[model samples]
Every structure is written in structure tokens, then in C-alpha cells.
Target: IPQFEDVKFEAASLLSELYCQENSVDTAKPLLRKAIQISQQTPYWHCRLLFQLAQLHTLEKDLVSACDLLGVGAEYARVVGSEYTRALFLLSKGMLLLMERKLQEVHPLLTLCGQIVENWQGNPIQKESLRVFFLVLQVTHYLDAGQVKSVKPCLKQLQQCIQTISTLHDDEILPSNPADLFHWLPKEHMCVLVYLVTVMHSMQAGYLEKAQKYTDKALMQLEKLKMLDCSPILSSFQVILLEHIIMCRLVTGHKATALQEISQVCQLCQQSPRLFSNHAAQLHTLLGLYCISVNCMDNAEAQFTTALRLTTHQELWAFIVTNLASVYIREGNRHQELYSLLERINPDHNFPVSSHCLRAAAFYIRGLFSFFQGRYNEAKRFLRETLKMSNAEDLNRLTACSLVLLGHIFYVLGNHRESNNMVVPAMQLASKIPDMSVQLWSSALLRDLNKACGNAMDAHEAAQMHQNFSQQLLQDHIEACSLPEHNLITWTDGPPPVQFQAQNGPTTSLASLL
Candidate 1:
């Protein structure tokens, strides 16, 4: 009977793999389900099959079913008295909920997981691994909420947990429990994950140089791992790293490099249909950022709209809507659509986003909209609100943008003294951020304000600064527009552009453009 069960399990697994390979995931799902149904006699095999089936559902983007399966797996692990694997299933479920922006559900689950990891008298390696998993979820949750300061403790614990795991020998002692035989991630993979989260935190905290440093290190480690193992998770990590770095490049005035890396992201995704499907919205969102940087309003709108259509993720949707509203505000048309989007993302009325940064950014967009409509008083109110929120969270770019925009408002009102107060600090902050657009805007405002105040010398210096920023931005814009990949802006529907497809992934040596 045991031999027959083994044969049945192996056959189902092999056939499912074959079906998945042939892109017949639908067929594979039923086979896995049947296998899972029959394996209830063997708890270990049953749990494994459940996980595999859940992964299949996740791959197909049916997160509801995946989450339900994970929940079932957790309960089953509990029934078997394997607290370790129960934590695994619960954490996995929590991750999916986080992806769905179901923070309300995730908070309680993570809390319970943390308690389990703390109290469980398990194998040290397994216990440490669970701590790492629990801490990662906590750090990511805080980061997603844009609470950089709040995430520090969890991140530190995660770093320490990984180090502890690295020092422990995997074969020192076999896990006593069959369910505890698994590792959430190997030491090397866990190291890279820690680095990735650190980079994410640094970026959110406005420590651009630190982010670049960690990104470089993490990417190098990923490259070495890829040589020996071509796991899809590795590729996913690489894509996310590249995405963050590309945004960094744009902020630091390296549009050409960002554009090149955008193509790299596309190429990497093209290698797997699942990767492409999962990341298409992000890819389009990145392209939209590029289009905005290059001053192509129409293309930016198209890309953002495509992203909005493709993404059901709440945070990402809020982000895209905010950006699209900015483009509409800039073009000074499409007032109706802009108003509708503004209402949806409004922080005051059933706001969807929990990220402090996005809420501040939304306020900034509302302020910009008011400014454009010549409602200076109303615009000041919104900008001041943004400033308070950004300052509290150290959202440097938002703070700089808010300051410069407020300076512009003062200049338009002929309040030179007040304008100077805002613009001087804005320029200083922008210079630190190296946000070229904000710097340029601030310099222009300074030049006008100084001129209006009859300070010819100061005005002349501001004029020179403004001219230099203009030439630099113009040069980068020209180079970015000249790239072969520039035509990716036109891609909105269907698969990626055929021309961008590659037989192999791009090189991994992305140096920091900062």
C-alpha cells in the first residue's frame, strides 16, 4: 500500500510538471488537487501537495484560492502539531494578503506568527528561519505603509536573524519533525533578501547613496547565484532590484541609464510568461515615469492608463492615479478625468492608500492642481499639508517639490520675501536630492524673485544656475529620446514589443548612476 501511494504521488507530480512545462497550468491544477486529496493519509506529502497546488493557483493570479489553500494548510499543520510549518503556511498567506493590500488581515496574522516563532521550542535553524520570515513580513508591512522610522527595529532583527542562520550549520542536526525538514530559504538566498529589504528601506528614507551601495552588493550576490541556479525567484529579485535602481537613476538625472535598464527589465520578464504577467503593470508604470521625465505628456498618460488597467493592486493603483492626475494637471486639459481621479485618491475621503508618502504625494498633486487653476490660497493650504506630512516621514523629494511649488506660488503673488524664504531652502534640499527638475524650478523662482526684489547680482547667479540645469536636462532628454528602446512608450496592449524580446537575460553589472 505504501509503495502504491509513493508511485501515485510521483506520477501525479511528474505529470503536473509536464503539463506546467507545456503551459497547461489548468490541467496541472486538477492533477495536483487530486493528488492532494489522496495524500491525506501521509501528513508530510499532504502538506507538500497543498503547497504545490497553492503555488499553481498563485501563478495563475487566483490569489483567493491560493490564500484559502494556504489557510487550510496552516490548519492542517496545526492539527498535526507542527507549529513550525504552521507558521510557514500562515506567513505565506500573510504575504499574499499584503500583496492584495489587505493590511487589516495581515496585521493580526503576522502578530500570531511572531508569537509562535518566539514561543516554539523547535530546532534552532527552523526557529531562526521562522523568525526571519516573520520579521521580513513586519518590515515589508511597515515599508509599504511608508513608515521608514517604524521599520528600523524589525529590519535590524531581520538582519541579525539572517546572520544567526548563516552561522548555523544546516546539517548540524536534522530537524526532528518531518514538517520542519524544509527551509524557507537557504542562507545565501536569505542574505540577498535581507540586502534587498535594506535597500528598500534606505530608498524610502531618502538615503539614496546607501540604497545604491546595498543594491550593488545585493545584485552582485544575485548574479553569482544565477550562475549556479536559474530559479524564477532569483529573476524576480533581479527585476525588483532593477526597478528600484531605475527609479533612482531617474531621480539623480540619469535618464539614459534608466531607459536602458527599463529595456533590461522587459527582456528579463520576457523569458517567462508568468514573470511578464506579474510585472507588466510595474513595467508600464516605470515607462510612464520615464515618459514624464522626458516631457512626453501624451505617452506618459497612455502608459499610466495601461498600468492602471493592468493592475488591481490598491497601492499601485493609487500611485498611478496620482501620477496620471499630475500629467493631466500639467497639460491643463482633461479636467473631468483629473477631478475623478483626484476624488478617488483623496486622503480625506475613504483614501485607499496607507503609505504616508503616497498620501503626501496626493496632497502635492492637489496643491499643484489648485496652483494651476490660480487658486493660490487653496494651493498653499494643500502644499503646507504635504510639507508637514513629508517632513514628518523624511520624504525628501516630496518635501523639496512642495517647497519649490510653494515658492512659485509666492512669486506669482509678488511676495518676493516669502518666495525667497521658500525657494532658498527648496534649492538647497533639491541640490541634496539632486532632483534636477526641482532644482531647475527652484533656481528659476530664485532668479525671478531676486530680480523683482532688485537684487541684480543674486538674480544673475540664479540665472546662470538655471541655465546650467536647463542644458543638462535638455542633453539627457535628447539622449534618452534617441534610444532604440524609446519606442516602448507606444506599447500599451498585448504582449511586449517583439523587438525587445531576447533569447537571454541582460548582463547584471548595473553600476550606480548616482
Candidate 2:
């Protein structure tokens, strides 16, 4: 409907962006198609629209279409002489390749992206944003590929880029729906900033506290600019904050406080379910972990199943699979599905410091499965691998779990001296972390070690330690699980039946969505 070619080209680009923002691929496709058609006549438009279409397909999970679009975008970028767009498109394509598990295919695209960004001459600030996105993408690639040394440089670059973006023009933000004449500013740039902050927090690469602080600063900046009403953008901040709060409480040994935070998260999702899909899935998975720690198998199962149902991200799905595998292993199911899933997901067999925590859990849980099945040699191998990986990491719970497994492996192999050494280290690490789950596991191992050695005094001391830790854990839980004084449920009977189910669709759990 635009009369001029320029107007028509701009209209198509804007329409495609709007559709992408709203998660409306069907609505965005025709606009992208028109843009592609127009670009054939005008080569300049071709580079931009082709890149946009590539990203669109990536978002829609249509990898083949995205690859085709990226090929065109790469070609058009060369024809149109735009280094910035070329770098951006290549990075997008590289990430898609990484997701497809095509590890070899990503390096060339990432190298090209780096080359283009290094020479780009757009406004220094805009060029810097593009560079930051690429740097973060590169970091992700390294992390996923287990190239631990390569990650630090990207993290350093990202820190510098964050500082630059903080000083960017105040006019960069705009109302989400009004779509004013904002030439130098793009709304999606802020969205990208939110994502970068999130990745920094999740990876714990460099300056996590600083990243959280920046999130607060960004939120304040958005508020001052009256952009707080942007639901999708606002949801991103809320999601990260909620997750951080829960993790902080759990890590600090305030299990009760952490459980209470889950209630608030549930409330957040109930208010705007679609807006918080990613967070909802993540919360459920965490809740399942909490349930498992407390020996609530039914609740844990419900939570894990729910998490798998709610989201399709490979990482999220992998977490659920690992947890459920532990559950089934404990319940004596021997199909080996969990082992297969972990092997598939962890093809590179990485144990980077950042992911060492997850790797520890995976290895320790599978080792426990082997131990229960009396495969002592297999258990010893898995547990020792997990222990070796736990060194130089800050994951208190995982380190504790690994040590406990190592102790059990030593005890099984009839090495009492080594068993004692492992048990003592495990208990010390478990004590450093505030999680009752690790405390219980460590104490149980200590008691077993004492009993095997026929040391009555050592056994008695361990029993006492176990009693104290158990009491501390239960007291924390009791305080945390208490409902508000005003909303407390007063029962005329002793306790409600376990079979009583809440209506309203079986009480959708955070685990169920994971």
C-alpha cells in the first residue's frame, strides 16, 4: 500500500519486526516475503530484510528455512557492502547451528562475524551493541563447546560493552506500541540488553552481582522513560529477579524462605501466564529440586513433569530429564532412559567451571543409580569423574554430593582410610552450603563409615550431628511452609487426606510446566 519504493521497503521491515515481537510468525511471514521481493529490485534492502527473515525463521524453530535465509543474507550483505548487518546475520546463523548440535559449522560463521564487527563503521555506539551481541554469542558457543579458556575474553568484552551501553543516549527507549519517529534508537536494542544481563547472571561468568545491579539500573532507567508498561520487557526483569531471589534463599540455607518465594513466583505466573512462560518452567524445575531434597517424591515428580510440559528449551528439558532419571533410579526403575538422555545432551562431555555444577549433579545422580544397582566398579568410575570435576568450583551442594559418592565408593572398595578422608571433606563442604539436603546426605555417609569401622564413639557423634542437622532443616521448613497469619487454614481435623486434590485443573505445579 506504500506508494514509494522506500516507504514500501520500510513498511515491510517494520511489520516483520512487529510480528516477531508479538510472537506472531504467521502474521510476520507475508511482510517478510514482501520485503524479500522488494529487496531483489533494490540490493540494499536485500541485506537487511534477508537477515531479518533469517532471524525470524530461527525464532520460529524452522532451522532449515533459517539456514537458507542466512545464506541469502550473507550473500546480500556482500553485495550491499554492510559489514554490520553481515556480522549480525552470521552470528544469528551460527547460533542456530550451535542449537542444531552442528558444532563444526559454527566456527566459520563466528569467525566471519568477528571479522565484520571489527571493521564495522556505523555510529560507534550502534556498532558496539552489535559487537556486544556477537561477543555474548561467542561466549555461549565456547561455554557450550567446553572451551573454558575462550569464555573469559568474551566475558571481558561484554563487561566493557555493558558500560558503553549504560552511557548511551537517553532517547534510545520508546513506547512499545506508539512507534514514534525514533531514527537513531531501536526498541529491540533494550530487549537485547535484558537478554545479555540474563545470560551473564545465568553463566556467573564475570560480575554476577554487577549484572544484577545493572538490571536494577536498567529497570530504573526504563521507569524514568515511562517504558515500564512494556509487558514483555518488564516480564524479563521480573523473571530474572524472581529466580535470583529463590536461588539466593536456597543457597543461603533458608529453605523455608525459598519455598515461600516459590509461592510468589506462582502468583506472578497466575497473573500473566503467557508472559512468564520461560520463568514458569525454570521455577518448576527448581521447585522439583527442592522437593527431591525434602524426600517428597510425589511432589518432585509432579514438578518435573510440569516443567517438561511447559517449555521446549533443550537446557530446561535436559534438567528435567536428569532429575526424573534420578527419581526413577531411586524408585528402582531400570530402563536406562535417563542415562541415554544425559549422554545425548552432554555429547561434548564438558565440565567447565560454570557448568561443572550441573555436570556434578548429573554424574553423582547417575553414580548413585549405579551404586544402588550394586555396580560398584561403574559407580566408582562415575563418582570419581564427578569428584575430579568438582575441584576449583563454587558449587557447594554438588561438591558435597560428589564427595559423599566418593566416600561410598571407597567404603565399597574396602579402603577405609580413603573413605574417612572423603567423608570428612564431604561433610565439611556440605556444612559450608546451607542446603539441608546435602547435610542429610553427608551425615548419612559419615554414620555409615563409622558403623563399618565399628567405632561406637564416632558413630554416636555422627548420629548426634545428623539429629541436629535434621532438626534445623525441619524447623526451617516449618517456618517457611507456614501460611500467612491472615490466610492460615484452620482445620477441625488433624490433617487433610493426601488424596484431596485442588480443583481448577489439578493445581498446575511449576514442575509440571518444566
Candidate 3:
């Protein structure tokens, strides 16, 4: 009260950031309000303070207020006469929507952000960091929509952006506090974002070995972040890393190991709720899948329910809905929920063919539900549509799963020739992958189909092969699920060497996460 406006604003700003770093946002909020009030007489400080307050609203899950604050921030940016600040605010708004999976509204803001960053004449690091952040945001946009090829250019641009940031002067410092630096994201935070999006891209692009390799790299980078201890951002990334690691394990058939990893991550989340507050949907979804695999229908339903409540993204929520319908179908659906669920999901795509995965999923699940209900013609049609329209590497496993189900539908209908034909290609696709996890169910189908056609010798041989693959799958669980003791994650081109005996362990680059 005794000091000038600038002095009071400076003191209040630093105190707000210190409180935030300590995870004491309650303390920070009041201090920010006071700072905003004091700086109301000055255009720059006032608008910047408004942005800071909006960030607090975002943290509190009050998105309406956050949206209004952005509007207010825009007016202040005009008053302060800073195009860069206005562009930065637009970028921030885009990022918020991006995280919500609101792709349609983000592209315009991102287009403007790229233009602003290109024209910016600020400190080199700040400009470069903004560029990198935009690159990552673009990559995530395409990746989640299942457009892997679209991300190629963005990935190349991201690498160039990162190199540019690294060449900046080390002696210079940028604002680390959100209250003071409402304009741009930090370099460390930018690096983390890039690492995460790239790893996720690898997973969705059908490169399980590459996924494991990058997850390890991202985890190592997360541990080395130069941020506040247990930073909520860092914690958020930790949850995401663990989720992907578990995903890699599951994709490669390490059910026991994946469960172990999930247990460890659940405990970690319990111990640190700040980071994983929004992460339960994925964790529960994975658990539901595992439960379904082992015929734990009731448990699967419960996990899926929890996942549905936690899911915010439409596509992800759609997947859970599909899975939940499958569980209901398995239960014989005395309640008619499966048909209702199926009718509710629209199988049309508006933008980005990447969403074809979700449409394809709807077809596959409907096919299965039809098969379960003894509607053979409807099952065949839905399964055929799934094979034709759902395009993406990540959904390849689901397609393979649908084909095996189709073959069984043929067998149940006494069309032995059709069953054999369907299974042969399915097995071929599954076995082509280095990790045979995708083809696990195919082996059993092949065995049954061989027996159906009177090839008793081939049937017996397939039975042994199926047993050997199953045993090897279980043995690799422990190693696949655990964190690596080293930095390198190795990889090779083809299916790994097979060992028939239990005496020898798994021998593939995908087996080691290190």
C-alpha cells in the first residue's frame, strides 16, 4: 500500500509463482487477484495477470471462466499494443481445445500461431520453443485422428525446431512462472510435449518396437526435467509414459507383465493424484481389455464403466462404448443395451480419414454382437465392412481380431471352405508382425480350421505351435512389464527367433524395453 504500482505488482507476481511451484494454488490465487487489481491501472500487467488468472481457472476445471478470461486477455493484448501477446493468447486457447480433442476449432488458431511465430523478433529461444510446441500440437492432431502419414512432415519439422532451440544462448533466461510469462511455453515443457507426442505417434503408427524404444527415451527425459519437484506437468507425463509402456507390453502379449506395470502405475497415481487426476480413463480401459481376454466379464464391465466416466475425448469414449457393448453381448444382453449402443454411434467421418478407425471399430463390434446373437448374414455384412473401411496401422490388430471372429461365424454356419479361407489370410497377417501377440487368437482358429477340413496331421502341428506361442508369451511378461535398467532400446526388422522349450527365454529386441 505504501509502494508504487510497479513495485507492488512485481512483488505480488513473484509470490504467486512461488506459491504455484509449491502446489499451493489457493495462496497463489489471492495474490494474483491482488496483483491484477493493483495493475489494473497499467494495460500490460493487467492483461498478463488476467491470463494468469485464467490458467488458475483451467486448473480448477472451470473451462467457461477460462474461455471468458481468454476473451478478456485478447482485449488487453490490444490495449498493450502487442501482436505477439495476442498471437500467444490464441495459441494458448488452441492448446486448451487441443487437449480436449476439439480438432475442428484448433486449426484456425494454429494457422495464425504459425504465422505469428514466423514473424516474431523476440529472443531466439522463446520463438523457437513456440514453433516446436506448435509442431507437436499439429503432430498430436493428426496422430489421434489416425492419419500417420500426415504426421511425417510435422515430425521432420519438430526435429528441426528442437535443433534450433538447442542452438540458442544458454546464459540467457526466460520466464519460468506462468503469472509473469503468460505468452509462451517453456523450453523444457516444450521438449516434454514433443517427446510424448512422438512416442504416441510411434505406437499408433504400428511400430511396437519403436514405441517401446521411444517410451524409454521419454521416461528418461521426464526424470531429467529441470522443473519443480514432482511438478504436476511432470507427473502428468509420468502417467502417460506408464500408460504407453503398458500398451506396448499388452500389444506384444505380456498380460502378466502388463498387469504388473498397471499395478505399479496405479500405486504411483494414488501416491500422486495431482499428475494423474485425468488419467484413469486409459488405465481402466486397459484393465477392461485384459479382463475381457481372460473371460472376466463382470470385472470387465465395471472397469469399462469407470473408464467411460473418466473419458473426455469422443473417440476414446466411443471405443469404451463399443467394448461395453461387447461385454453386454457376451452376457446374452437380456437388457437390449447392445443394440441401443450400436444404434447410438454414428459411423460417418467429417474430417481427417484417421477417424476411420472408430467407424471401423463400430463395424467390427457390431459384427461380433451379430455373431453372438446368431444373426449370421448381418454378422457377415458388418465384418466385411470393417475389413474394407477401417484404415490405420493401430487398428490392424482389431481388424485381425474381427477376421478370426468372421471365420468362426463361417464354421458355426457349416461353411467350412469359407472358414478355412478367412483364417488363412488372418493368420498370415498376424504372423507377419515381429510380435505374435496380434495373432494369438489366430493360432487356435487355424488349428480348428485344419481339424474341420480333415487335415489331422496339420491340425496336430498347429496345436503344438499354438501351445508353444502361448507359453513363450507368459514367460516374457515379467521383463516386458518392468522398467529398463539401461538407456538403449534395441530393434530388428522381422519376427523374432522362436524357442520351443521353456528352458530358453524370449530373444527379440522387442522383449527388452532398455
Candidate 4:
């Protein structure tokens, strides 16, 4: 009877396979558990069963649970001296960490995995598979650090590994998402990551259309990935894609439509709590930003506060606190509370936000509050710091925004020459992004400053630019109202997950594959 355990496992595994074929997790899970129990005496198959269970959890966007299952499987492999299974579990764990944006933790584990896989005389396909994943993790790290040069070598190595494993044995597990049964899943995912990183870099460089192009490509690939089993990664990619879209829309003189898009997403999330709870913090934060764009201070404040309350992630908390402080400054209320939250800012605090955006946000909010409270000198200090950091990070949009704030500080302090100088570059940068609102305000200030100094020609030019921006903004509103409301995005989404956002997965980043 004890020897019959393998027979029992095969039967249960078959039933589970049937359930999986139908995408019926409720039926599949119990069967998998039974199979795992039956296969306990067979460590190799038991580990495989645990992995299948973890994959199910991953598909459901329950990455934490997936990690737990993999952990147990790893320990079981080690106990049984199953080197290949241990290495496989480690690779899966590393991928999960990479998806979680825990970059610091990923490298060490992946390095060890590479060593173990290399030394062990295991299945060649599995070794190549681990090698490919390891390279991807490295590539991701380099991209996040904005070192495109460093990524190329790793990418080359990954491609070579893929090319080497041209044929798969019937016993081998296929490497993550294969496109059209020819291209490996890792290859597709690498392309997705490459496009996404390039999009973010392009945005920082103030190349809006280039960023949009890359975003469209990345979104297309992400949609294709949804056809596979893992929705968690795909869902995270969709979030990042939407963030890029909103930013592009806001800057390219489509603020009204951008606001409408975020509003629709927020409303959809609210109606479908499962589709939103995990991403509530980001969704609410985006809504707050839209409200701020429309000068809806009360609504923005509420949305930001809700976002803050929803997230327990330390970095996201910092990001939300900064936004909330901005809202408080805008309302000219609760200065002390704003300062209290701002006090947590260390500039050295581990920020998971893209390219020092969190630090820029902190300084900008601090400067704004100081400006509102009439502490001109303090405001100037913080605003300058904000600009320095933004420029250092090559975050062109934030730098432009900071320059506008700095110009305002100068104008109020009777430093007309400096104010005028600041506004000129700020307007240039704003025009590049086509952020009409910033351009409008900066040009208006320049016009007034020029007129007050009795410079008629310069005043007229500034006045014309301001009027032009106002008209452009009005035109945008009209176009937005005239266009039909249905989403024109052409990509196909996979079958909607029954439990969409579980709120319990690993915290990646605010605007990441979170």
C-alpha cells in the first residue's frame, strides 16, 4: 500500500491536470494538495507538485503564497538531496523577487543559483533555463540603475542560452512564456522589460512621443503574455503602462482626457474591489494627481489620504505622504501636519520610486509649504534642492516643474532678473513636454514681470505665449468633449481573473511591475 502512493499521485495529478486544462483552480488545488501528500515519499515529484501549486498561486496574483510554497519545496529538495529541484525552486523564488522589485535581494540569490546550477551535473535544459533567468534579473537591475550599456552584455548572454537550447525533450519543462511555440517566454519577457525601461528613460529625457511608442509596444507584448497562465506579472505591467499613458496625456495637452481616464479607472476599481484592492494605493494616488491637475483640492486631498491609508509599503508611504503634504500646502491649511510628515524625509531613505522621484517630491512639497507659509528664504532653499536632484536624476519633467516653482519664489522676493531668467528656461522645458498649464503660469508671471519693468516688447511676447497656452488648453477641453468615450486601445486582455487584486502580494514599487 505504501508502494502504491505513486499510483495514487498519478491518478490525482491526472485529475488536477484535467481541472487545470479547464482553468478550474477550485478543483485543481485540492487535487494538487492530495497529490503532494501522496508523493511525500517521492521527494522529486513532491517538489514538482509544490511548484505547480505555486504557479497556480502566481496566476491568481498571490505571489506571497507562491513564494511560501516554493520555500517549502526548496527545503524538501535540500532534505532529499535533490540538487536540480533545489536549483529550480531557487530560480522560481528569484524570479518572484525580481517581479516584486526587490532588486537588492535578487542578485545574491541568483548568483548562488548560477553557481549551484553550473557545478551540478543536472539536466542541461534546466541549467540553461536558470542561466537565462539569472541574466534577465541582471538586465533588470542594470536598467533600473539607468545603465543601458551594462544591460547589453547580459542580454547577449541570455540570447545565447536561448539559442543553445533549441530543442526541448518531452520530459523538460518549457522556460516561462513561449510565444507561438517557437520563441521562449523569457525572450518575450526580456523584450517587455527592455521596452518598458526604455519608455521610462525616454519620458525622463522629455521625449514624450518616443516614450509613448515604446509604451504601446510594451503594452502589446504584455497583452500577449496574458494569454499564458501568469496574470500577476501581466497585471503589474498593465499598471505601469497606464501610468505612462496618463503622464503622456497630461503633458501632450490632453489633461482633460487624462483626468477622465484616471477617473474611469478609479471608478472601475471602486466598483470591482477585487480588481483594485491590491493596486488601490496607486489608483487612488493617480486619481489625486488628476484632481490636482483640475485644481480640485478637496477631492485630491481625500484621494491622497485614502492612498496613504491603503498602503503599508514604506516607500509608497513616503511617496503618498509627500503628495498629501503638497495638497495641504495647496489648501493653505494644516502646515504643522505637513511638516510632521515631511520630517520623516531623509533623502537617504530607501526610495523604490523611479529615478529619485520620491526625493524630488519631498523637496518640492517642502518648498511649496514653505512658500505658502511666506517663508521665502526657506522655500528658495528647498526648491533649489528639488531642482538639483531632479536634474541630477535627469528627470526633465520634474526639473521643469521645480524651475517654475523656483521662478515664483524669486518673483515674490523682488528678484525680478533671476525670476525672469528662471522662467525662460522653465518655459522652454515646459514647452518640450507641452505641459500647457506650467507654460501658461510661467509665461503669465514673465509677462507681468516684464510689464512692471517697462519692457513693452518682451511683455507682449510673454503675453502672447500665455494667451496661446490658454487657447490650447481650451481647445483640448473641446476636443476631449467631442471625442467618443469608449477605449480605443486595441490589445486583447485575457479572461479576467476571478480574484484580481489580492492586496497580499509582495510590494514592488508605486509605478512598477507592482
TM-score of each: 0.92, 0.71, 0.78, 0.70
lDDT of each: 0.87, 0.63, 0.69, 0.69
Better of 2 and 4 by lDDT: 4
lDDT of 4 by residue, 1-514 (tens): 7657667666777788788778798999988987887677776468667877998888787888898898888787777776666777877888888667777777788888878878877456656666666666676565455443445567567657656655645345543321101212454565575566567556655668878888888888787787884745556566666776776786777766775565445444444445576676776676666556556677777777777777776556776777777777777767687667777764546444543566776778778777888898888888888787777656677778888888888898889989888888999988887667789889999999999889999999999988988898888766644333212111112221222221465432233464
Query: Which ten contiguous residues of candidate 1 have the minimum total lDDT?
Result: 505-514
Residue 306, model 2, lDDT: 76
- lDDT of the structure predicted as candidate 2: 0.63
Query: By lDDT, highest first, what's the ranking?
Result: 1, 3, 4, 2
Instruction: List the pairs of residues colliding in candidate 4.
Output: 177-185
Model 1 lDDT per residue over 1-514, tens place: 7578878887898899899999999899989999998898777778888888888888877899999999999998999888989999999999999887777898899889988889999778888888888898889888889887778888988998888998887666766666665678877888899999998888777677778899999999999999999888999998888888888888878899998899888888778887888899999999999999999999999999999999987778988999999999999979999889899989767778788988988999999999999999999999999999988878888889999999999889988888889999989988876778888999888888888889999999999999999999889999888777788999999877654432255423343232
- The alpha-carbon lDDT assigned to residue 462 of candidate 3 equals 84
Off by over 4 Å in 4: 1-34, 37-47, 55-88, 95-104, 113-190, 200-206, 220-236, 263-274, 344-355, 452-455, 477-514
lDDT of 3 by residue, 1-514 (tens): 6547767677777888788879898999888887777676665577767787888889887776776777667656656566556666777777688766666778877897888779877666667777876787787777667666567888889978886786777544553333224436556667666777777776665566777777787778777873445556777777787787777676677666666566556656665655455666776787777666555677788778877777676777887888888888888944577667777674543421246666777878878877877999998898888877634334556566677888888888888888878777777766643346546667787788789889999899889888988888756644433433100112011121121122254533233556
Candidate achieving higher lDDT, 1 or 4: 1
Per-residue lDDT tens digits for candidate 2, residues 1-514, read: 5548767787889987887778788988887887787667665566667767776776566898998787777666666565555666677777788777676787777787787878866566667677776776776665554334446667667767766776776455432321111122243445445444454444342223444455566555545544635545455555556566556556445766666556655565656645455466787777776666556666777778777787666655766877888877776764576566556445236522234445656777768878987898887787777666655444445666777777877887889889889888877765554445666766877787888889889888888888887787778766654434101112112121122123444433455457
- Kindly state the number of residue pairs that clash in model 3: 3
